[model samples]
Target: MSVVTEPKLISGNANKPLAQSIARRMSMHRGMSVGLVDARVERFNDQEIFVEVYENVRGEDMFIIQPTSNPANDNLMELLIITDALKRSSADRITAVIPYFGYARQDRRTKARTPISAKLVANLLTEAGVDRILTLDLHAAQIQGFFDIPVDNLYASPVFALDILHHFRGQLDDVMVVSPDVGGVARARELAKRIGAPLSIVDKRREKAGEVAGMTVIGDVSGKKCIIVDDICDTAGTLCKAAEVLMEAGATEVHAYISHGVLSGPAVERITNSVMKSLVITDSIEPTEAVKTARNIRIVPTAPMFAQAILNTWSGTSVSSLFETDTLVPIYEGMYSRD
Candidate 1:
């Protein structure tokens, strides 16, 4: 496939603000009026999604910015319909920019009759004519293999690390990064390495989904400022419980940095009432009213990183460099620099 100079951005109803932010970042980088494509994504009386592209996109590089977050099925269907519309409109290349990919937790079958929904979602997107996939912090890294097309899984660790550094202001003493579970040790370790902090793990057993049976701290956290790092925080039972456990273990204070804040059910309440000082989440998934109003919850923007990623993908440049600790500072500074 040949490269297209002008890229067209299209947004679904999933997260319009984030899409707009990405477009603004792109425009700032390119020094041109790079805005979203003129398209109408709406629903009928019976809630059937309908998409119509008003502007001509023939032979144009197209990017659809839509995260399949809450109301997962509706948003997922909207993405498919949008992709189909773009394909039929003769767009040269179609890339789906999904910040938060739904059905990711169901990457594998846990029971006899269960299905691998993550793979199924990938197949659906492929069948819908998505040429490339760009997502952030997938629950499982192996989910990339589910797609036959090119998959670019971006890490939020660099962004998280910058925020953590800014929050702590170079204070590395008595700080600890804790993984909520054994599966998340890698993610936590990456953040710890970036911030030059010690790493710990919370060994937890799950009786079922969203319920923690028991937990054990794998490292010393006594009298230290504990920071829990994880990919997703749904229901937040494990997260809140882990924070309580850390306090009981004599930690001075606790905080959390999660990539995707699913925050379903009693998650917000749990975080609000828990011993954690603050819960910082990325804006991959749009924050709901509860999340926005939560006292101790904070959000870090991902638009700059994603905007840089999209530009890299469009220009055939290296996307991995954005996550490198040394390179990330200059790149991030450049994003906000007026020069």
Candidate 2:
């Protein structure tokens, strides 16, 4: 008989609530004691990150849950330090669970003499001794190739689909899934298929970052409710502009569903004054006070999906089943029993 090892969960200062939620779900559903590893992560007098694991992790499977969200540099440094600590402690396997990978948007250099920062971050983690990586909805799917170790990219489509159904409740006939840009058509199309809706693309031209030159709706959205889908919503510039264009093109109602809500800068203010009815996002990144107070923003919990993925990874089971379900209730029931 093969022996199954329970993986220990750990968290840094970045998004601790999400880490706790994942750990709690795993313990409740798997009928086992899945506890967070005790650790101290703080900055020194000069703001240098320090990490120390209190519990013995020697020869133990460990998963560190930390998202490179706000204060990106600080959080990223903390993750690297945490991974190094785990390695020195002799952990059998270390998986860096980054729900929202920062610098992922810089996957490739678009201009002359620019750097591919995404690859640099991947190299940093690998060098820090992370045995594997588990992230959600990378900005560019090709970013997975940047890492040398095993990378499992989870999706937020399942969570978003469930919320859409419950919110609309059998009245999705006139609903349409829209891609905010040509590059995101694949992601939008997949979500549209899951919800049994048609797909539309926003043909947009960007002159530079956080600036939209022009946008046009490619498909017929006349008198239909539209849901713009994308992997990340950084500045809300493109999304807000796209929503305005959709409304002008005769969309009855406009909404957005994105995997990561990196709502930086004036995103909250922009969304509040835009035509989008609501901007639904997954809890991959911790929301700011502005996001929480925004009347047009709703957050969908992704803990259930992440919890099952962790279990599957520890047990060497396929984690792809998580994307096949519209709702997460069955996954929360421990669908792949280890008995």
Candidate 3:
């Protein structure tokens, strides 16, 4: 553990409640509120963002909380401006605490001439003056290498996995861990191992943009309770389809454990109509009213884990043991009554 002195707390206009929650959990007071010049965001006709940090942040260790969720461009820009503001203010360290990192799904160019937006987002953040980055549950693991600075790709698996294990107790056997797509097999496997469950894969193909329906099952799901896992459920298109496929493939129950519920567009309606028994998502991103009130959708919090991470980081402690070994081993150890 490296000694980090004089860490500061600076937050953007995104996910204020979650920021406050994290700060509260850390048992720290907000150094100073970054106020706006104008209460109403009255912008010029050009639609350019206007930003001003009212408080001074000179020589501070600054941590900015912003979830680049809906209105991604705006929220992302706000984060950048906050970072730039902190950097210009001579903050000793500027850590961007983004709970939900947007544009992470496009890590590679799937088609000819397509942009690798994930890399672009990383470059943009780096260019925007983020000294180090702390985020949760990136869609792709390799995105950590995209940043030159020390990047912390936190996992929501522990939070969700532990919660599911406690909720379902001994009814875990015959439960299948499912990856909605092939890309998420590693993450799904981790969660599956944690819960002491077998694994399954959903072979899916996207028909068109903003549409995801399942095609076939790659593993046996007969007479099993299926928990479909994915990093982000943007429109619930893929998850809805996966649940339907699992249920159709003789799965007794089809549940989805997603980390971030961006749930844009018709996501709420889609999940409402899907055959899934329940949809578990984290509060990494804020939930809309429809999502909040939805009966099937449940939110697990990442605050405790993230709060612990922040405290551990500030305290020069090693959090490397956090889900370091295959999450499944310890999970199954707890299962089967094994030490």
Candidate 4:
């Protein structure tokens, strides 16, 4: 018989609340005390990051929860330095749990001289000594190929689907899931199937970054309540434009379910003025005050999903089963009910 070792959970400066929530869930599931690693992640006067693991992690399985969110460079560096610290401390394994992967939208080169920043970020994590990666809803699926180590890309579709059910309360026949652009049709289709709704796509032309020149509805959304779905909503330009086109095409109501809410610059303002009734985003990235103050935006916590994923990873079990949308409602309701 082999031995079973307890895993150690650590958190970087990014998204501390989410890390804490996951730690609690893990502890609850174990029915024993599971604690987070006590560590200090700070910066120097010259802005160099420093990380210290206060406890001995020698031979222990280590998982660091750090979303490469805003202040992307700093959070990214923190993740790297924390991984290096755990590696130097002789941890048996290191898995970086990135709830929101930054620079993911730059996965491909639209122009000849453009750099593929997503691959560069992946290379940095591997070189920083990460044995595996756990992330949610990568902007591009092909980004998994950039990593040499095992990468588990979790989906937020189940979470969104559950919320949709609760929001609409079994009135899904008139609802339709829409892809904001051609690239996101697959994700939208999966979500539509999960929610038992129709599927539609918006054909769009991007004149430049953070700008959508035009959008055309590809399917019949007439008299249907459209739910635009996508992975990220950075500047909210495309989302707003899509909503307009969908409404023009006679959608009864327009809402959106996007995974990451980067909400940079005029995003909140744009969303506030858009035709969308509500913009539901996951709490993968820590929300800013502007997000909290946005009237039309609502946040769904992803902590339970991520917590279960961490537990499964530590036990060497497949987490893909948890990805099924049908399993989400009960899991989410149970977890939140206890709170």
Best by TM-score: 1
Tell me each candidate's TM-score. Answer: 0.96, 0.95, 0.87, 0.95
Candidate 2 weakest ten by summed lDDT? 330-339
Give me the displacement of residue 72 in model 2, in angstroms. 1.1
* Residue lDDT tens for model 3, 111-222: 9999999889999999988888889988888899988988888887776677677777778876889988787899999888877789889987777886664478999999
Arranged by lDDT with the best first, the candidates are 1, 4, 2, 3
- Record all residue pairs in model 3 with backbone atoms less than 3 Å apart, i.e. clashing: 7-61, 8-61, 193-328, 194-328
**Which model is ahead, 1 or 4, in terms of TM-score?**
1
Model 2 TM-score is 0.95
- The superposed Cα distance between candidate 4 and the true structure at residue 216, in angstroms, equals 0.9
lDDT per residue for candidate 2 within 197-247, as digits (tens), equals 999999988788767789989999998999999998888988999999999
Clash count per candidate: 0, 0, 4, 0
Clashing pairs in 2: none
Candidate 2 segments exceeding 4 Å error: 1-4, 326-329, 332-339
Per-model lDDT: 0.91, 0.89, 0.76, 0.89
Expressed as tens digits, the lDDT of each residue in 1-339 for candidate 1 is: 655778789999999999999999899999998899989999999999999999988888999999999899999999999999999989999999999999999999888999999999999999999999999999999999999999999998887877777777645687899998888999999999988899998899988876688999998899899999999999998889999999998899999999999999989999999999999998999999999999999998888888988999998899888877566666576432222
Error of 1 at 244 (Å): 0.1
Error of 3 at 52 (Å): 3.1
